[model samples]
Target chain A: MSFKPDHEIYRRRFSRNLGVGLCLVAFVMLGFFLTVEKVTRGNPLDALQGKPYVAAPVAP
Target chain B: MTDIQAQATPAEPGFGDFVQLLKPRVMSLVVFTALVGLMVAPVHLYPVAGFSAILFIALGAGASGALNMWWDADIDAVMRRTRNRPVPSGRIQPCEALGLGVALSGISVVMLALATNLMAAGLLAFTIFFYAVVYSMWLKRLTPQNIVIGGAAGAFPPMIGWVAATGSMSLEACLMFALIFMWTPPHFWALALFMKEDYSNAGVPMLTVTHGRRATRVHVLVYTLLLVPFAMALGWMSIGGPVYIAAAAVLNVWFVVGAVRIWRRDEVQAEADKYAVEKAFFRFSLVYLFAHFSALLVEAVLRAQVYGV
Candidate 1:
């Protein structure tokens, strides 16, 4: 539908909420990536590459 | 310019009203349960991937809420409790809500597939469809068994979270699903007992409106009794521990006592006291669901330290 002046506020509101939601998602993704990487001392993506973790060898 | 051309139109809504259309209240529950499901799963997700899974799942929840508002606008407009909601109040047009719902639904599903797996994405898509179309559009106005079957939409999130991490379904996932599904009738019907007039006035066929308060009370007690076993079973299963077991035991006793009290009261007593018993039960039901889920998280953490699962 074409925007009437009356519809402009809602349109802007919709656009604004969409931006906020997307930004929040991006922030979460970055936070998780950085924090988890720091905790594990390596890139988390490395785990998904068929190697989640390596175990130390058993003592003889 | 014509006289009409000279006039300035007032703004229809602010940013907050659009957020309301997405039902932030319900979305919070969805996000929390979905997060728990992801966290407690055996397969560990890269934290960013996990975040993406939750984000899309939340958007999917929001999408369903918007669509429900769009479809239920007619009933909502007449109900005293919902009369001022965004769609019903005319702050946002129904078509706008629909457009937003559809767009979010597609975006969430596609993004989830990219972030996780086809199973999780598919489950999310089905959940949105179930809530918006199957439940809101069909079951709601049609049956008192509405929430009974329709509760599946809400129940899917934790399962979706589980699937997001594990890429498969298991008994644990189904148990989580069952907990919400069974808990819904008592939760909503308690609200219905107090808000029967709202549903009646809106022509919605809620149990309290159709079956009378007496039958509704019995239904509440029966459902709570049934729900107790399942709630406790979650504690018995792998996802739970002593913390959960104790919480479920106490919550169930508290819930059953409240349900029993409601069952004993008649309409005369209810009106005189303004549905105090029923209202208390409804309030407790919120805590019941939240606490049970929170306890599961606690148990998961404890087991991680002890059993290393």
Candidate 2:
């Protein structure tokens, strides 16, 4: 059992969006993966041990 | 944050409730496929890295479940099948589920990024987002096509595993993704067919609730038709071999025949045995998915030992 489409309108949107979302999501996924790989691969604990993504506030 | 924490103090949740929050059955499938994905990839993972990667992925899956339970508690309370879940049973508060889910999501993603490549971590992130936000929050309540789109969340673990091993996606990885994505509709719909009253009671607008059983039966046949080729095709891809192809052929023949029987059932025939065909088909759906993925793993092992691939 599944959804009853209100009409063919969602049917069309569903089909189109599945394709669009697949590609968009895949692209972002790959981009994020590569970026993280570049930043983190050398050391598992680097985030903990090294400088943060943002600099700590300077002492007054 | 303080207000939410305040609510958790009044009720003590046992260890089992926390375990239940993870939805272990679903996690096991995630672990299985992700392991297969990693093992079959051209590049292998270190034992420790592999273990860690899988741990994080399972956590990600658990995170999605927690978030889903948190969000769906209202409708869940209405469905007999889901009414006893931790949140609705009052074993844990919604805020606790939400907090646990969000915390696990961040921890799993960050740790996976550390343990594997960015790609695997990113895929895990998308998977959680897809299940929690896209599937749970939006598509589920709004469409009868909910499972169709939401199935993608379940489909990502294998690909994430492959990425973990190779630090990149490949044809084999995509095929694994396609295999699960294609398999989800029929699998879930089969359950929906038998559990129609639960959907009706819960006001969930499932296919049986909206389209009626006849249409759902036909849809099962049609989707099963679509699924077979995609499944068999993987036999010819980098991941495929004689063993996998042979297993796929046998499994799919049974699957299609079952779907056809389901499609052929009329109200009279179905009611005679209380949806026996539908129920049988639902049972087969589980075997159908597990068999295919297991076949892939078997082929990989065979090749490793025999063919030296």
Please name the candidate that would achieve the greatest lDDT relative to the true structure.
Answer: 1
- TM-score, chain B, each candidate: 0.96, 0.96
Q: Estimate each model's TM-score.
A: 0.86, 0.81
Output the lDDT of residue B149, model 2. Answer: 94
Cα lDDT tens digits, model 2, B76-181, are 8999988999999887899999998999999889978977889899999999999999999999988889989999999999999999999997888988898899
Q: What does DockQ give for each predicted structure? A: 0.19, 0.02
lDDT of 2 by residue, A1-60 (tens): 997756544554565466547745954664565455445543435666764644469999
Clashing pairs in 2: A2-B207, A3-B144, A33-B118, A33-B119
lDDT of 1 by residue, A1-60 (tens): 875474576687777778778867976676566456645545656666766455658899
Which stretches of candidate 2 lie above 4 Å from their native place? A1-60, B1-10
Model 2's TM-score against the true structure: 0.81
Docking class of 1: incorrect
lDDT score of residue B19 within candidate 1: 84
- Where model 1 places Cα greater than 4 Å from the true spot, the runs are A1-60, B1-11
lDDT of 1 at B77: 96
